[model samples]
Target chain A: MSKKRIIAVSMVLAMLLTGCGSTAATANGTEEAKVEQVGQDTTSAAEEKSSDGEVITLTWLNHYAEAGKQAWVQSVKEQFEAKYDNVVLNIETVDADSHKTILQTKLASDDAPTIFDLSSNADLQVYNEAGYLADLSDFECLANVDAGLLKEGQVDGKQVGIPIELSGYGIFYNVDMFNEYGLEEPTTLSELKNVCETLKANGITPFATPFAEAWAFSCYPRVLYDAVCWNNDGAFWEKLADRSLKFADCEDFKKQMQTVWDFHEYWGEDAFGTSWDSAQQIMANGEAAMIAHGSWAVDGITSYNPDINLGVFPMPVSEDPSECRMIKEPGQQLVLFNYQDERIMEAARNLYNLIYSQDCMRVYAEEAHQMPSVPGDYNILPALAEIVNYPAELSFSEAGLKRNDPEHEDVLFETMMNAYTGSTFDVNELVDALDTAFDNIKK
Target chain B: MRKIRISSLLYILLMLLAICIFIMPVALAVLTSFKSKPELAKSILSLPATWNLDNYKGAVERSDFLNSLKNTVAVVAPSVVIIVLCSSMSGYTVARHSRDSRALRLLDKVYLASLMIPFQILMIPVYKIYKSLHLLNTLHGMIFMLVGTSIAYSSFLYVGFVKGIPHEIEESAYMDGCSEFRCFWLITFPLLKAISATVAALHTMWLWNDFNIAVILLQKENVRTITIKQFYFFGKYTADYGMAFAAAILSMIPVVACFMFMQKYIVNGIVVGAVKS
Candidate 1:
């Protein structure tokens, strides 16, 4: 009756009506969208599915959230659903940063995904200890997978994770920029430093180290560690793990750090504030000529600039070029969960067998631009071809680090971040800190 | 008079600077949304060579803007309504009768204690409880959790505001033969409108942008809110900034409009509530 009351009532009415979504046959007229969210479960499809038959939802929590990977995953889901009409793959792809928290909560609860991805060896061990891993040691499809790659996912000598694909880290350089300056891919430590100096003199930034990102510490900095020790057949790691080696004793390790400290000068203002995304954009825009990251970065880089020409070479961390090798490791692994329901577990198995097949993995290798863990003839990214095909003596597999306790790699990443991030860089302090950290890890 | 004018001028200048500081990021997001990735990489502060609507188009397609908007509205609207209705009554009873009522006194203490516990602490337990109830990934559970977590703070605000009101307003209605419920609704409720609007507006913004509760509770793709939908734009190593900013700019519109509409009530409610009974 009153003006104030009338207005309040109408606002509530409007909110309620809007909240109760009125379905309209809305469509963007006649043009396909370039960037679209894929794998949306339509209500109509769900209804149609239930109307005719029983279709179970197999939940999967994936870590790949980028557009290029999502598109490939969307196709994979569709193909799987079409092939197996009784099961709908309820795939949820969260960004890698927050995926862990969501996943830990879900995995602990009754709502855990039947299948999930773990980014690190430490994660595999933790989840395996929690009794979440569904003893995939007997999984039949794994017969075709490389034993060495499969070992990367093994925890306590028990096969838990099914290695899906692998990605490698290298010194990514802009080929066009390198060609413009007449600089070849540097092989030795001296040549790499020389390239940085020349690029700086020519008013081009040589490296866009995304030191602001905690994960970036694992990319280029770890490559430095691997370069010094990778050639010794991981004897340095074995001794270090056994507390027999001090980081200070390795002269090459100090040389690598000194090289890093030199390269640190090439990073311009806000260097520590540079994010992985900003670093890639800077490299793509030709603001920076080089970034040391991995095979996974190619899609993101090329998406930003379609015409950008890129190439990867081994990070020259040692004076002896032969000792400097690119670091390629198994990426995320898909581990089956221990489920009680027979129907759900069967569906999970069907999905697993389908995905691990060469036909499905080809999409991952070709589109996602990473090497499949399974033995398959797939074309590697042209930019990464040199590093992937680098002469055996000049390249190292991350599976070599598998000799050391899997958890040591995580400690090394944190220690390197601490050492590199300090205002004062000291080789002795860095090595001592690393030695102490390894000692602290539970044997 | 001259001194006062000079002081006023200084205050105005200070206010403008503060406004700019607050507005700059939003302005940057808007500008970035209109630029291509190359242009954005060139300079985050520079104007675009072309006012490209393509990013907005891409974001609309990529974020499922319409469905997420519908879901956000569904969760936020009902949660705000419940929070306002429940908090107002609890606040009124606690303010008016807590001295004589033992149950209300205990509840007030419980709510006051609950406010100190952060949502991050309750995230796992709440998730587990919801899973048992088969409420995970449902709008029903999402609304319930949002209201449950928010009611404590909203009631505290109402309790503060309700205590400031004179008890004479309700007494007069009671003297005229009005029942307690009718008297409170027709008489005291109108007087409490300012705080209610404030509560509704604050909760709308908070509930709309709520990530912690919604993220854990609403994991399904179709049930995702705009905040969750926008999260997929970022990857571990890279992000599509142009499209993400576009989604941010678009999503901010409803929130901004709601805040502006209730701006008067929010300021008045806070100022009134800050005064002692």
Candidate 2:
């Protein structure tokens, strides 16, 4: 009787599973088929003007899923659809890690996103070498952007991407602390050191340099590079890769690095166990006067103390105020794959025109809470409002791409931290270690 | 008798300590979930300054929590049942016939060998094949890949458990004029319940939290599972730890409930299998 009951139960369960599986499978198949038909429709849609009264869907795969960005994208989508009734701009946002994973296949396939950016500036070389990036040098929509600003996203002197927004890395200082100490924002290295001395005298740490985390500390090298080698393009990186240059031999690179000795003296001693969050805590809670971080640090600081009066400035690397520059990189680049269908490519270009339009640029700037990338009268970050204007004469220094020696980046960062955390700092030793590590990488 | 009681009490206390050690992070997550951003920054370990539903509201609106939940159930439920049923049949046949049939023996060896190869090695190749089959961006396709990738290891589990079971039970059923299908399902399968429950529970948890293959295959918004949705959730919203934790707890409730319920059967199965062997 027990055996009969077990058989009966098993049969019923099997029958139920089969029924559920078929219903779900059929529904999934219908979804898949419908999506395929849309792909075919987009391919067959009208080219350029969308003159045949068919909708051309431009699929854009991006990784900027921030709430502000989503709002801005939606605004652009509505404006774009209103302007061009025949063209539909479809956008999908994935995370950076997964975007990079999907792009491994998507970039090479013919069915790639109509508009998307490469994961890194270094990838411009790889994707360009593969002929996967569309050269938009002749794009009339991109004509308003300064040639120099657009050059950061280029490879082999062909414009491959338009810089969307800027991520400025600099000194995030406590405004209230500076005011209480009667310290004006420092614009040169000597003044910065004096400010550090005043903060130290007042029993506050000056810099939360985060030596415990190599990636957080890694941005310090860019600070030195920004001071000495602003706008060298990818020349410095390619030289380092091809045995043409060594860090010790690069004079400008070595010139600004001596300031790190002061950094080590001020903050490196107790920073061995500090993380980015702890460093932010130190700044927000008034334990530290400033942090060697970027514009993105504001959110973390505000989360700690909503009323924390904080400001950003270009970390002065030399005595001359005129030469001071923010260490800068693109927050994201707007790009299209060359492998996509031509009609879809044209539709994406039209959408780009609207995205870079003055109205849309203002929206993008306000959402990013940063200065406008292109030349425009727009709202700027209040923290950055004092010392800078749109397209300030003081420029930005883009990091040299480590094309072949990618892992050597961590080696470089770890070496910097390792040098700074020592009892005494030596600039030459740090630079020598960097050169040795770079040389050791198999080209 | 007093010494014995004392030792037993100590053992139970140690087990309770072990449970607390494991549960600390979860307790912290629940605490942090109720916090606002300021409260989170003030202290991650302490209670929220003011309990509110705002973080949960933001997580729901942003993550499409319910739709992803529906999709997760759609993918995991059918996949687990199919894996259990098919692997059990294959395991039983191979366990019974491998010595007599060279093909069956080779098939068993191949399944065992395939377990050693990592998914990273197969990821790109599977992706390319899926693309050619127009299986990209489809939940059913993802389901197919999940079932196919999981079968080899699942079958290997069943094969070991079946070999340990007495064959005379099935042999007697066949001799009593019962069909081979009835003999296995009615007589042998009921006896194999402990191991079957273990496999079902293990695969259910795994398929719930699967990210890699799901990330690659389920690229469309309408088809995304909860894990993939959370990947995008934490991408740029990580600054607001209160909201991040809220989103985490919301997504975790179902899977944690699942694990808690399945955990008892899993432990019992393991112990019963050990005793029988």
Candidate 3:
């Protein structure tokens, strides 16, 4: 071979070897770096303070990027900084859609946020099991929180997080349209049916389903699931969790599935194609009398028409009005990562306490338009009057079920979707599917 | 003459249809971004009553567009340069040695195989690897993954282009006592410019529009890319879609600017990478 060929071949050989070498180096480098991080953490654990008066920065990751919530978080940051001259609060927010994955990744990494938002119920349970949470059982802020509300925030009988706000799921009706049609808020299944019939007769859509999105479509079924299954002494979820019960065994589930069918019939012609925001528009514009949604959607509707006279009411799925109860869940909560530094832990707790104080809760209630977890009186939005007055029940949220079986929520959501839309959906078939899926999940 | 005119007319019509199909969604977003919330609720497809810039202002303020733009450029520029350098060298080797040795042939085969492995399959493993390496939340970490994920296809292109070059040029250079490194750089590299340009343009497009790698690797507010910024912006303003649309449109500007800047090289690169090989 010519000299050029030899030169070219040697260059190729060297370049190819470098590629292979770098990958092995990357893997070995990874293991070594992790060991180094552990060493650093150990050495730094005892040195929590930054000399005498140097500012110690605490990083907080949250999902409250919404307009009003952002202000509330900013207020907390300002107050926390004001109280502790030696500390600075650094805030970062990721959107809710990707928050869980991003937060989980950060928690497993060395750079976990000092404070973060813990999704209520099962999400909290997962992190608690991993020892990623700082036990806030002795945190003073929990003292002022209503006992029942505080109890809901607990996992393994330990208070792991502080509820930022509480909200419930129900029907948001156009009050002007209801009054124009001389309709009273329905208190029973027959009454709801009659109301729908009357609205239909008046050339108005009784319900705007927002079935284009599966989660929104699942809202009514979820609320109905609470009323029917939850009224059976609240033991249904525990039985499901322990594998002693199956969805097929619940007679009330089938009855509620029929209400799912009724919701489908009442859904407007464009329901399958209309989005959640558009459905709110339909309700706000008085084209639809009601939308089955949660408290968060009140702002969504009011944004479209600021003067939209909206009111909330429980979906009367059962014949007996006494069985009706709105499904409530604590919205967002402040939770701390298990940090080794005592000073950092103290700073995070101080911030948490400041954020949930009665003064701050009042601002949160007024500004966020979300109900306070603490029982002291605050200005409640008129739209929430019906939900606040109605009998409320804490249902087995899918997130709670998901902690036991990761696939349970997916299987349930799919089943609900199929039940709502599938022409040949049988309750028995649905129940069998649910049972089979639950067993598979357990396996 | 009539037949040629008619054929030309048909081509123009076809191009127009393609353009319309591609541009309709972008145009809709632009139109919707100009509308108020009430107007959007009234009709999504209708022209705005007032052509307002409130959505754009809100999106710019909320998404922290300037900081994200700086971060995106910081990540993309260095990463693209690294990808081009590594892939060109590797591609040169694979193309020349594939016929001579099984090891080089196997190396080339691996590059081809890497192309088949989807990014999603590697997402978790990569995250774990990144975490262990202390590479999480850093622009350097993002740059590393972007270059790693892109090198295989780009090297594949380089290898093909390198193969077609006459070995006589490098052979003669070696006869004059030029070292392998010197000969490859002075002679072979200059010859590989067309393909190198192609590789740079192609990977720039890939890295510029990427969300998954950046989303997984970069978590800090100071290091966020435009795609993740827009994702968070839309999440924040889901109830206010006019503002979300404005943010979406703003995010598209950088990618479009990149394509426009690389347009000449891109068209040539696509042709050369596709047909010349």
Winner of 1 and 2 under DockQ: 1
Model 1 misplaced stretches (Cα beyond 4 Å) = A1-54, A230-242, A340-343, A375-380, A403-424, A436-443, B1-12
Tens digit of per-residue lDDT, candidate 3, span B1-277: 9999999999999999999999999899999889988888888889999898999998888778888888888988898889888988898888777788888898888899999997755665577678678787898889888888898899888887887788999999999999988988999988877777777777777787788778777766788987777754443324678887898888778777777877787666556666643
lDDT of 1 by residue, A140-235 (tens): 778867676787788887778877876777888899898998899998877988898989999998888788876675677667867666556566
Residue pairs whose backbone atoms clash in candidate 2: none
Q: Among all windows of ten consecutive residues in candidate 2 chain A, which has the lowest summed lDDT?
A: A23-32
Order the candidates by DockQ, highest first: 3, 1, 2
* lDDT tens readout by residue for model 2, B22-126: 999988988877887666655668887778889889888787888988999999989999998999999899888999998899999989999998776566557
Judged by lDDT relative to the true structure, which candidate is superior, 1 or 3?
1
Evaluated on CA atoms against the true complex, candidate 2 attains a DockQ of 0.19
Candidate 1: give the clashing pairs: none
**What DockQ do you compute for every candidate structure?**
0.24, 0.19, 0.24
Angstrom error at residue B103, model 2: 1.6
| Candidate 2, residue A29: lDDT | 15
How do the candidates rank by lDDT, highest first? Answer: 1, 3, 2
Query: Could you say which candidate leads in DockQ?
Result: 3
TM value for model 3 = 0.86
Residue lDDT tens for model 2, A1-443? 99989998999999788544421101111121111212332342123344566677777787766676667878988998899878777777787666765665453233556777753566666556555568888777777664445766778878787877666678888999999999988888889989989999999898886657776776666766754664454566667766588888877777767776765667834787887777777777788988877676775676578698888788787888877776666656777766346666667778878877778878776775555456577775566554245245565645333333356667767777778776886778878998888888744
